[model samples]
Target: MTSGLVSPKRPRNLAERLVGEFTREIRQARLRPGDRLPTEAQVVRRFGVSRTVVREALSQLQAAGLVETRHGIGTFVTMNRRDSGLRADAAEIATVVDLLAMLEMRIGVESEAAAIAARRRTDEHLERMRAALDEFERLLGAGETTEPADFRFHSTIAAATGNRYFASFMGSLGTKAIPRAHLKLPDLPSLHHRDYLASVNREHEDIFNAIAREDADGARAAMRTHIGNGRERLKLRQESSDNLEPRRKK
Candidate 1:
C-alpha cells in the first residue's frame, strides 16, 4: 500500500521523519499489530528516500520493540501504543519545556550512571561505546540521522554500569533520549547543524575518555557537563524563539 507521508518543506533527518510517520500510523491504530509494513523497496518508492534510509528507519523501529522482521518475509508491527508503558512519544515531547524536563531527569540519572560505569566497565563495554561513537561520527559526516548511534553510545554507558536496571532505563527511553531526534525546531542552516552536532560529538568524546581511563569523578563531571550543555542549548533556543515570536506575527 502507498504511504500518505509528506516531506516537510525544510530539511530534516529523513530516517527520523520516516520513523515518526510510521510511529504515528501505528499509534493511531491505522497500522495495527501483526500488520506488515510496506516493503523496503515500497518504502523507498513511496518516500523517495534511499534504501539505506529506509533500512535505518526500520532498524530503529525494531530497536524500539515496535516491529519484528521475519526472515524472507516482512516487517510486522509487534505492539500497539498501550503495550509500551514507558515510551516517550515525540508528540508528547513537542515543547522546549518538555525537553528541558527530560534533560533534567537525564542529568540526575546519567551522571551517577557514568561514575558507576567508570568503576565497573569491562573491555567489551568500552569497545561497544567506541564503536557507537565511531558510527555516530560516520553518520554525522554522511549527513544521515545519528540518533541510533547517539542512543547506542549512551545506552552502552548505562550498560557498563554493570546494572541491568540502568540499561533497561536507557532502553526504555530509546531514541527519545536524544532530543534532536524529535525536537520541533525550525530548520537550521547546514553549517549550524554540522557545528552543533560536532560539538555534541566532542562532548561524547570527553565522556568516553573519562570512562576509558576509569576516572569515576571525571566521568561523572563529563556526563553532567554534556547533559547540562544540552539543557543550556535548549534554553537558548527557547529564548531565541521567544524573541522572534513578535516579529513573526507582524
Candidate 2:
C-alpha cells in the first residue's frame, strides 16, 4: 500500500483526500479484490488523520461498491479496476477549473431537469425538497458547511424529474458536486462564507418555488441562473487567487 501522507496543498477535505488515495490504490491494482484495507487505527496513524475521517472515507468507498466491510473482520476491496458506468473521480474534479467545467455542464443538464421536475413532481417530491432546504438553512445557521443538505436538495430535484437516470447521475456525482465541499471556504472571510451561502440558499428557494408552482419555464431559468452563478463565483475566486499570488511572492 502507498504510505505517502496526504498532501495539505489540495483544497479537498481530509475525508475526500483519504477517499482519493484509497481509490487510486484500488484502481491501480495495488489493492486487489479481497485485499483487506489497513485497520482503522493503522490508517489513522499512517494518514495522520482522525478516526472520523478514516471512517468517512471508508464509508464512501463502501457506498461506491469498491470495498466491503466484513463484520468483525475488515474492509476488503470488492472490485478491480474496471469501468464503472457513469462515475466521476473526485480527484479529477478537485480543482477550481474542473469545478467550473462541471458547473457549466450542470447548467445544461440540470436546467432541463428542473423543467421536467416541475411538470412531473408529486406532492411527496415537493415535501422532500422543502425538507432538504429546511435542513440546509438549519445547518447554515449552525455554521456548518451544509454540503450534504445541499446535495440532498439537488438530488431531490433530480428525483422529482421522475427519471431514474437523472437521479443516478446525481448519485454518481455525490456530495462532491457541491462546490463549497472542495473550495476551502473556511479560508475566506466569515462574511463571505455566510453571505455567499445565503445567496445560494436563496437561489435554492427560487428553484424550489418555481417547481412548486409547476412553472416549468421558471424552474428551468432559475436552475440555470443558480448553476451559472456558481460558475461565475468560481471564476471570480480564481481571479482573486491569481491576483494574490504575485503579492504573496513579493
Candidate 3:
C-alpha cells in the first residue's frame, strides 16, 4: 500500500510540512477518525521536527476540521475531514460556485495584503517576488506547471505585509489560493491555455509594478482585478463545460 505521507525535502516551514503529512495520513485512512495521533513528543521525535511544528500543524488541522484537540487529552481525527488539507482539495473544487467563493475570500484577504505590501515591502521582498515571477515565466516557457512559483509570488506579497498572521494564513491555504491550481474543467485549447497563462503573468506584473511604485491603492485594485478576472474565467469555463454536456448527450 502506498503512503501519501512523503517527507518534505528542505522543510523550511515545518508546521505546514507536518500538516501535509498528517493530512495525507488521515485522508488515506492510515489515521482514521477517532484515532488519536501520536503525542506531541512522539510526533516530534518520529518526524525529527520540533514541538512547535507539531503544535502548529495540529492547530491548522483543527482549523481545517480534520482534527480536534482536547485539553490534557490529545489530538484526534475529527469526523469532519472534508479535505486532505488545502492543496489536495484542489481536485475537489470542481464547480463554479466553489471557485467563485474561494476567489471572494482571496479578494478580501489578498487585496489588503497587496496594499500593505505596497506600503511596507522592502527591497528583499520585491526581489523575491521578482524572482518568483521570473521562475514562473521560465517554467511556462518549458510547459511545466507554474503552481509553485505562482504560490511563492503570492506568499511573498503576504509576507511583505509585515504581519506573520497574513503569511501564516497564506501558508495554510497553500497552493489552493492559485485559481489555476484548482478549478479543473475541460482543458482549454493549447492556444487558449498559453494565452490564459500569459494573461495571468501580466496580472502578476501589474501587482509587482504597483508595489514597486509604492501605490497602495493601485496594488489593492490590481489584486482585486486579478482575482476577479480569474473568477470570471472559471465561470466561463464552467458554463462552457455545462453547455458541452448537453450536446454530448445528443
Best by lDDT: 1
Scored against the true structure, residue 210 in model 3 reaches a CA lDDT of: 100
Worst 10 residues of 1 by lDDT: 1-10
Cα lDDT listed for each candidate? 0.75, 0.74, 0.73
Record all residue pairs in model 1 with backbone atoms less than 3 Å apart, i.e. clashing.
none
Give the better candidate number (2 or 3) by TM-score.
2
Tens digit of lDDT per residue, candidate 1, span 1-250?
1111212332236777787789889989899999999999999999999876776667566556567667689999975423433344443443456667889989988999999999999988898789878988999899987877887788778768866556556655656678766554555799898999999999999999999999999999999999999999867765655332211111
**Roughly what TM-score does model 3 have, to 2 decimal places?**
0.62
Off by over 4 Å in 2: 1-87, 243-250
lDDT of 2 by residue, 1-250 (tens): 1111212345356766787888899888899998999999999999899775676566456545667667689999975423444455555664555667778888988899899999999998898789878988888899975776777688778878866556556655656677766554225888878888999999999999999999999999999999999888867666655332210111
Quote each prediction's TM-score: 0.65, 0.65, 0.62
Q: Tell me which residue pairs clash in candidate 2.
A: none
The clash numbers for all candidates, in the given order, read 0, 0, 0
Candidates by TM-score, descending order: 2, 1, 3
